[model samples]
Target: MRECIRCGEQMKEGCAIRVEGSATGIIMSTKENAMFSGRIGYPKVAICPKCGEVSIYVENVEKLK
Candidate 1:
């Protein structure tokens, strides 16, 4: 569970962040040349309904390392 930084409330997790007008979501990569090489990951989101705060994180952190 995630906690809202602003309100100190429990945040709703397991949400996904997507690009506008695109099916693909946000990506995180460890390599400088991410398009061709290195580890990649899709970020997940946690939102606070009380204060409208949003937090992003990578689920597959091991993959990026």
Candidate 2:
């Protein structure tokens, strides 16, 4: 376990993806100003070793229960 950046308490990762079977999420565009959807892509993510900060950028996804 690790502490948060704003608070020095035990921090756990909030869900990056909240929608089950959700294909897409928020996107910002300056030139296009468009919102893209209907594409299934569940990106893999992991937690930091020291801080327990989770980020999604990996190439593989793991299922845990």
Candidate 3:
């Protein structure tokens, strides 16, 4: 388990987490019921436990390559 950056608390898997990504753009059109015709952003990301901040870049996200 890894500790959260904002809260310094342990981050467990299978737990509910916040995700950050682009809004009305290309990425939005690929999601369920997606209606946008532009690039959205990243698929999804997790938020900070203490500050609840979402941090995830779609363009930079990969399979840990």
What are the models' TM-scores? Answer: 0.75, 0.28, 0.28
Give one digit per residue, the lDDT tens place, for model 1 in 1-65.
77899999999999987689988756677876774466566778999999989999877777655
For model 3, residues 1-65, the per-residue Cα lDDT tens digits are 44566677654333332345844432433445644444354354555566665544343433323
Ranking by TM-score: 1, 3, 2
Which model scores highest in TM-score? Answer: 1
Which 10 consecutive residues of model 2 have the lowest summed lDDT? 56-65
| Cα distance off (Å), candidate 3, residue 19 | 12
Deviating ranges (above 4 Å) for candidate 2: 1-40, 58-65
Query: Per-residue CA lDDT of candidate 2, range 3-63, in tens?
Result: 5454455544433545567776533322343323322234444445565666554232232
lDDT of each: 0.80, 0.43, 0.46
Global lDDT for candidate 2? 0.43
Worst 10 residues of 1 by lDDT: 34-43
Candidate 1, residue 1: lDDT:
73
User: RMSD in angstroms, candidate 1?
Assistant: 2.0
